[model samples]
Every structure is written in structure tokens, then in C-alpha cells.
Target: MLRATSRLPAGPSGSRGHSRPGRRLRRAVVVTAVWSALVVVAAPGSADADPGLRLSNAAHLAPGVRYETFSVTASHGTAHGHLLTVDLDDARMKIELLRPGTSGAVTGIRAPVSRLADARGAVAAVNGDFFDITEVEHPGVRPTGSTVGPAVADGRPLKAAVPDGQRYGPALVPGATDEDVLGIGADGAARLDRLRLRGAVVTPSGTWELAGFNQYALPVDGIGAYTSAWGPASRARASCGTNDVRAAACGTDPYEVTVHHGRVTSASATLGEGVVPRGSVVLVGREAGARALRRLRIGDPVHVRHRLRATGSVPLAFAIGGYPVLRGGVPLDGLDETAAATRTAAGFSGQGRRLYLLALDSGAEHDDGLTLGELARLLRALGADGAVDLDGGGSSTLVTRPPGAAYSTVRNHPSGVPERPVPNGIGVISSA
Candidate 1:
């Protein structure tokens, strides 16, 4: 029932087949016929009916790592996607977060997925999280280029999530928070989990709560800590807007304190800029939180402690921001079924033994990308038990290293002509 097509070459332009409207209309009819035949191959009484999805041009990038291109006939139009199937049981395989820079910097710049993969020596990668892509609301403030949710790299906590209202991209589904994340645990398994920031600023007077860490936005009247992991982006935006209203006016009373080697070195009534030196922490507080920090004096002994506490038992080895779409083989209710656009998603199966990274292509002829609900169905049909939606639209991108290749290549048609630079991504690395 599945139609087989000739294998395409391994580059962005070659992966997708383009056609005129007349040819596309003809292909849609053929695709519809193919969909009818899948019912015979589909498991009887299966909740997930085959969605006219076909995989072709498959290749193995490394041991236990397979890459392929897929096309599906949707109501709107025929769509194309790229997929990566990674077997975690392979000792040579590992998944890590792909940020822009390699020197422990977590934000402040964006790069294409292909560039990020080459920098990390990854076999394959997909764009990771929604980010602060623009600064329209807060004029004069630079976009921090930070992800919406928490990020952990090499088992070290890099940053925490911003307030829900301050997050970029589409609205979160009910019951989904900005803290939602997709992570690989120390047990070498992938899972969807929530990570909360547990931190405090201990001063001579008292211990105050730390509500944010290396994030672009902080909760109203809350204290946030920034370290060297946060690059030289200005912290002014952190004080702008409220926790409940992302566009609310900037707070007038902002305070900042610098702690170096366990003691306060400087305190300012205004937020500071530039790189936070290694071993130093900058505490930025707003409103009442700022009032609390104003009590600290230079040379005062201070201790700042912070860590991302996962709801699950196993500690995370790597984690990135994203909201869950499919769980337990079922799509979440209230998922937007109307809006459709290019998307990137990550899913897991076989008790987290296998990970699937998917990115829908965006071309002029076949640009009707899948909706979140439709995307869930496609992932379920592809055998994902649970999946999370990553950054999409122009940010959706997939890159893979052809067998024995020196560098990775972009495999999907990015909506952005020059290829959009993203804040972070999921990287597939192999020792072999």
C-alpha cells in the first residue's frame, strides 16, 4: 500500500520534489489513493490510522542513527518532513542540547542548526526551542536570544524558564507551563518533564528567594540570578513587563548586586550589563524584590545557590525547552487544530530507547505545514508514545551529516531564505 519513490540526494534542495500546480493536483490524487490502501496494512481497531505518510530516501548516518524524508497528504495540501531515528541503546549514541557558543555561554546569539551541529560535532540536529526573537514591545532593549524554557547541557543547568506570559511563540495549551521540558536522563532515556528553579540569595540579613536564573524575563517582584553562562546581553529587559502581562510597562525601581567569591562586590540601583565573570553572580531584582536586595552592602558576605529541580527521579543529563503535544500515544486536548505551519518536534518510544526528531518542510508548492493536532497524529503513526513540539514556523529546521561526511547539511527547506538562526537545538552525537 505504501508507495516507494526513488531515493533523493542528501541536500536541502534535493530532498523535496517540486511540481507545478497541475502536477501537484495529480500527485494529490495519487496520494489519496495511496491513503486508501494503508487501511489494509494498519492494525485493525488501532486508534492511530495511517495518515497517508510515506518515508523515502532513507540513510544511516551512524550506528543506530537513521535519517529519512517523509511526505503526507493533508486536507490543506501535501506536506514534506524530515525525520531522524536514534537508538539510545547504542553505546556510541548520545543526545545533547545545541546552543550557539561552546564556551559555556547559553544565550545572546542565534545560529543555524547546521552551524550548531558542526560546532558540536553532532551527526544530526533539529531546532530546539521558541525564543525571544524580537523586541517590539520593549523598545531599546535587545532581544536576548534566550529559549522559553529551561536548558541543561552536559548535565549542568544552564538556564531556567521565564514567566509564562513572557514566553514567545504560540500560546501554551491548558495545563502546560513555561517550565515544561524534554530531557534525557542519566539512565540514558528520553522523557518529557518539568524543571523548577530552586534557588536562594543568602545575605547577612536573611535568605531571599531566587525566582529566575539566566532567563530573559523574571516574575514580577522576584529576584533573578545571572552567571557567566548568560552572555553579555543587557539585563534591562528582565525588569520590563510583569509576570501576568508580558507587555506591561517596565518597572522603574530596579536593583542589581554583584557577588564575587562569596561576597558582595558591588550594588547598583540600576540593572548592569556585560558578561558575568566566572565564579561571580549578578542578582537583579524588581519592585519589592529590589527593595530586599538594596539592604546588602559592598563586601557583605553573600551566598547564592541555584539548581533545576526535576519532577522526575532520574537526574537530567541534557534538557531543552518545549511543550508536550502527544502523551501516552494520545494528543492533548485543546491543541490548535486550525493554524498550520512548518514545525519541529521530538518524540520517544520503546521505553525511551528510541528518539524521533521531526521537522516539516516549508516550500512554496507544499507549504501547508501540519497543525499541532495533525502533527500529533503523524507522530503517533510514526510510533511515538510521547512527543513535544519545539520551535516552528521559520525556526523549524533539520540538519544531518551524510555517511562519512565531514560536516552536517541542512536537509529541509527552511522558510527563511538565508536560514534563520535559532537560540538552541537538540543534537545527536555519536562517538563511533
Candidate 2:
């Protein structure tokens, strides 16, 4: 019932009903352009596009664990660098501190990255914390900060809490991430938090509040405790030895409380140099800290509380140092403009589901490394919801165990001739 339209044959001229060859080509071009425009308009936003991360090598070391190596050339300067990222799943891997040298010995010494990972059965690891470059007479180096701050390792308090502030920075400021705290719960959940040490000593006259703990040479004015675990070399200026020792002559005024199994055995004005009783907690203080001790009886119980609003979920925690670079997907406002060198940093995304361990290589002469701002931007580009700068420079090192291998190996070059000894390290405990 349908009839086709008729076209006249060309007789030394173009056909009346048919389109000319040049005309046909023009129509086709217009149709193609319209189709292309529609496709572009229908596409997703730039944010939904590929993040542009190109990996040279990527593999799974364990279930939910990914190791990737990538190189990036900056859009700005001739800056380019190599990066190694350890992507860990919170369900399968957990974060922990790896102290330098043997466990429970002097802690601030240099150990190979490979050795720390192997000792802890960590699949991957990175150096942690800024520490005293000043050499100690004993086996280890001192941490740069006065107090070790708040730390929990293997479900035990490693160092008691101190007030939340940089020893050299503002006082009692708690929210700064560069000097903030990090903690992990038993369920492998991780978070950034603020912490401070609070305690009180009870006496017949009144209760004297204690301010800090393990505050060895930190210039902050507060009374605190120093245990035998702090070692014999007192970094405290008022204390006896700086490099070596002689027992106190017994006229000193700092109060020493010797607590044996939760009962106060001895309280003295004389804090003599000696090994702290194996099962004792020694509360040491100066001035007001000593004043409170004068009123306490030998049998009085001492209570020290790390005042945190009972985060029942997080039973384990530790303090690591870094300036907060990114928070809530935005770079923090006022980062320093220091010259870029090798850099090491850590971040987490997807509300703590994925942990990113990053290390950038130091560049050659005339090559400017990433500044703090640049590093922050890089983390954002890599999809970090939160990020912090870790101990870098000569201290920047990353180590990983090859699949099926018994030992781990250092994968990045350290800027130091011999890698610097650090106070602590952060590692991934993949194996029990």
C-alpha cells in the first residue's frame, strides 16, 4: 500500500528529486556534528572521570592489600617524582608502631626498614616521628619532643599521656593534627584524635592535680612522671646527668612515688638514680609536683588518668607527629613553603576503608621537590579524604615484603648517606 518517491534520471544536468553529491556530503557532516554534541552533553562530570593515576606495577600481596608503583610529572614546573603506594584494607591489615632497634631496649636508634618489618611480621612499613638528632651516651637517641605524649602499643600504655601541645608550639592547643594523635581499636578501626594527660594525687590536706608524664627535657612547665622505662640518662635539665651519671646526693626536692602493684610503697623528696622496681610506677615531679608529694602517706594510693572522653571503642592508641595536610577532601589552609626534598606521608579514604602509604623520591640538583602545598594537592588528586605528612627527608623510607618471600626489603632511596635513626615507625601488621 506504500509507494516509493520517484526521482528523474540525470540528462546532462542534475536530477530534480535527488540530492547532489556535494549536497549529500554537507548533510552527512551536519548530522555527525549534532550527534557528537549530544554525546558530550550526556557524559559524566570531570570529577567522575579517571583520576589519571598510571601504575607501572600493581599487585596483591594479600587479600585486600595492593602494592603499586607510579611516576608523576607535574602540570607546573619540570617537577617529576616516583611514588610507592601501599593500599591496605582495614578489614585485613592493621597499623602499629615499630620502634627502632630491639623491643624494650633503648628505643631511639636506627634499624633497617627490612628488619623492623620482619620482626613484627609486617607486610609493609614506613618510618615514623621526628626525633632528637642529638646523640645520647647510651644506645638510643632521644625523641625531640619533651614527652612521648600519649601512646598505646600492643594493648599497653607505652608512654603515659602529656598535655596536648607541641613542646615548642602553643600551649594546651589540642586540635592541631601536626601534633595530634592516632589510635587503632581492637577491631582494626583507625582514627585521628586529640589527647591529654590528667591525674590527681590525694592527700589529707587536699587533692593535687598532676599535669604530665615522661616529660624529660621538654621545656614545658608541668609536673609529670618518669618511669625506669625512660632509662637512666635524664634529659631533664634539673636532673643529674646529661651524658653520664652519678646517683643523686639525696638533697633534691623532686618527689618520687614508688608504687608497687597499685600500693604506694615509698614517697621521697630524694629521686635517686637507679632501676625503677620492676613492678613499680615512679611518679616524679618538680616544685608544685613535689609539694603535693610532701602531704602523701606511704600507703596512700596514687591515681593517674589519661583524660579522654571514654572512647570505649578505641582501647589502643599512639601519638605520631605530622602537620595535617588535608581534611574532608580540602587542603589545610596555611602550609609552610620549605624547599622540597624527599617526602613521606600517609592518608586514608572511604572513611578509613583504604589506607595509602606514600613516599616521594628526592630529586637531582636544580630539581625542586614537592612543597607541603604540592604534596597536599597530590594526595587530593589521589583520592584521599584525609592525609598527614609523616617523617620525611633522610628519614623517609618505605619497605615491603615480596609475595612468597620470608624477608622484606627497602623499596625507596633514603636521602641520607646512611639512613637516619628514628624514634619510631608505622607498620602494617598483615600476619599475626
Candidate 3:
């Protein structure tokens, strides 16, 4: 799906007597070719060695860079990825996801999505999402490169694609001034808390970097009733009314979610002891009591596992300038990626491998946020070309269970279920 750019400008005939413009252009070509060759011969430019895995103990998972992102996939209640609740900056960092498909098919988001417009900025996605690149700031109330820190660490600088904007310390960019940027030291210690990047990525966030992303396909977890597939005889566990999937709580489907390992249960993130909305869960409940689902929660470590299936029929879209888009207006399908998320139905036509396994780690929601390097590595582990960041912390949930269970509870914040219900949850399910 990668596109080739226009070819080099044509040179004039008669090599030695060309005009001034032609001569300069010829020089440009020579220089460009040499530079390209150097790049080809260079080492496999890993932005940096994997973080803290090199160090004995690390406080957080960040590789010390900043960015914005959009990644969407059908995890369907399987856990091939981690949903740890760490922190970076909430108001400063945001991840959104959607499954834009109808009935049984799926779609990918592709388009020039409008951005909300902020200070310095970054954006990334999987199938794809759209937004404008206003700006991104780090650590302080005001957003500016000066308030930011260098993304480089341990002898690694920004990625090759990073344009020159400002050079604070040892930083460099297209518009980079020698006076801008903060906290980049020759000894590799960051001076500032967080550094902000001002550019934007137009494609799926994790794809270009080709790092890590998770995807999954599983049976639908029904609400209001349990499915026979997840009954007592089945190895799958069940829970309700507690943030801790393994703990017991007092509530009648009290909007609480608990995960169980065999017979014992643990941990809980109960918002309030109240029944969730009717269409907020899908956990293989009995048909008589089943309903659509609304949210998913990736609450903690210890999780449940389920086999997943996918059809590769979903489409993703981004809201650009308040309108839906596809391919950031580049054009793949008739509709744009912004619009495709909303209009897509089942049965999209593409002749590629149509299966994926997504991992989900329910809870690691500490007061902090997740990082790009951590996400990339996770996605790579999931065998994804990329992975999208969705609502997390209390807002992450996974709904899947046996076919004989009675009900599925809500365990996340924000909206309980996605706008619509699907067949499964790609969760990292586990037993107590």
C-alpha cells in the first residue's frame, strides 16, 4: 500500500554547457544520490536500543519521545497486547479507536482527518485514523518546543523522517533553530520532563515505524445473559460487579467487572454498585438475556485468554474538519477513511491475508500514561503491522466468555461499549 513519489527532475542535454538553473539542479541530483547511498549502507537505524530492558530497573515504559496516534483493530475480547495503566500526560496524550464495519465485514481508516488543533503535535494509527496536526507541548500548561525535551536517549536521536524544526542542545530539524529545544545533553540525560514534536504522521501510526501492534478476533461476549460456551464446564471464567475480575462484590450486575481464575477471583475497579446500560456488554451470555455491548476495560495484569477469529472486513475513518475521511483524502475506496468508519458494512474486497491475533492486558492503569516505544514493541509481539491506541485506564474493557454464562458486566470508563457491538473481545484473559 505504499506509494512511490515523482521521479527526479529531468536534466538538460549537453552536459557541460547547461544554464545556471540546470547546473544547480545537476549538482542537487549528485548530492541526493550520494546521500541516498549512504542511508542504504548505514546500520539498521534503530531509533534507540529497547528502553530500560537494558537497565536493571526502570520507572516507566517510555523510550523518551513524544507523538500523537490513531490505531484501530478488532481485538474481539482476546489479549495479545498489554493495557497497562502508566502515565505520560493525559491532557497532552490521547488515543482513539473504532471498528467501522457492518454485520460481519470490517474496514480500514484512510483519509486526511481534520485535527482538533492544539500546540505542538503528533498522530499515529494502525488501520488508520485522521486528525490535523496543530501542535504538541510537554510537562507544562503552555505548549511550545521550548517547554519540550529531546526525544533522543542513549546515543539515539530522532528518527530519520523527523524534519528540522529547532535544535535545542543537540536537536535538529528543517525549521530547527540553534536556540530552541530543551534538555538534550552530550551525556544523554534529558533536561526537561517531556519533549513535544510539532509534526504529524499521515498514515497508520505503527505501520511506518513497522514496530509493534496487536489485533484479535474472537466470539462475541453477550450482555444480560451468559452463553453456554462459557458455562461451568468450560475452562473460561466469568465475573460481574467488581473492578477486580477475581474478587466478589455486592451488586446485581452492578456495572462492576471481575475476572476469575477457575473458582477464585481477584482485583476490582468498581465505579459504583449499579447495573450498566442495556447495550454495554457482550460476553457469550444466554440468548434470552443477551444484548448489545458498549465498552471495554483493560484494567490490570492477571487476565483471561480466548481464541480469536477475524474477517478483515472492517473499515476505519477519521473525523476531519468535522467530516469523516478515508486515506486522509488520498483515495482508496469510493468513500474516504474519515467517512468509512461510519459507513462501512461487512464484506470489504481485498485479497490479502485476512487474520490477526490481538493481545489485551486488562489493567495497568497507574496514574501515568503509555509510551510509543512500549506500544510499538507490544504490537510487534502481536504480529501487527501497527496498533491503534484506544481509550484506556478505566475505559478499557474486554467482553468474552463461554456460551452458557448468564451475563457480562461493564469494567471500563468513558463509554462502556464501542458505539456498536461485535462478535468477540481480544483480551489477555487469565485465571486466579
Q: In lDDT terms, which candidate is top?
A: 1
lDDT of each: 0.80, 0.50, 0.19
Lowest lDDT 10-residue stretch of candidate 3 = 209-218
Cα deviation of 336, candidate 1, in Å: 0.3
| Model 3 lDDT tens row, 1-432 | 111122212222111100111111010112112111111112477333222211011111122111111122211111222222211122222222222222111112111111111000112111111111112221111111111111121222221111112111111212222112212133221111122222211111111111000111111121122111111121111111111111122222212233333211222332222222222211221111111111223432222222111112221111100011111111112221111111110100011111121212333332222232233333333222322232232223322222233333222212332322221112111110
- Cα lDDT tens digits, model 1, 1-432, are 001122211221101000111111111113233233222223567423545778889778877788889998664667899999888878788898887866657667788899999998999999998988888887888888888899998899999998888888778888888898888999999888999999887888677778889999878767899999998788988887766667777778889999999999999987878889999999998766677777789999989899999999999999998878988877888887777789999999848878999999876765888778778777777777889999998888899998778988887874456679998899999887
Against the hidden true structure, what lDDT does model 1 obtain?
A: 0.80
Pick by TM-score: which candidate is best?
A: 1
- The clash count for each model shown is 0, 1, 166
Q: Estimate candidate 3's alpha-carbon lDDT, on a 0 to 1 scale.
A: 0.19
How do all models score by TM-score?
A: 0.88, 0.69, 0.20
Point out where model 2 deviates above 4 Å.
1-54, 73-91, 101-110, 135-149, 160-179, 203-205, 215-221, 227-255, 262-275, 294-301, 307-319, 363-367, 414-416
- Output the better candidate (1/2) by lDDT: 1
Put the candidates in TM-score order, highest first. Answer: 1, 2, 3
Q: Can you list the residue pairs that collide in candidate 2?
A: 178-322
lDDT minimum window of 10 residues, candidate 1:
12-21
Consecutive 10-residue window with the lowest summed lDDT within model 2: 17-26
Question: For every candidate structure, what is the RMSD over all alpha carbons to the true structure, in angstroms?
Answer: 13.4, 23.9, 27.3
Local lDDT at 136 for model 1: 84
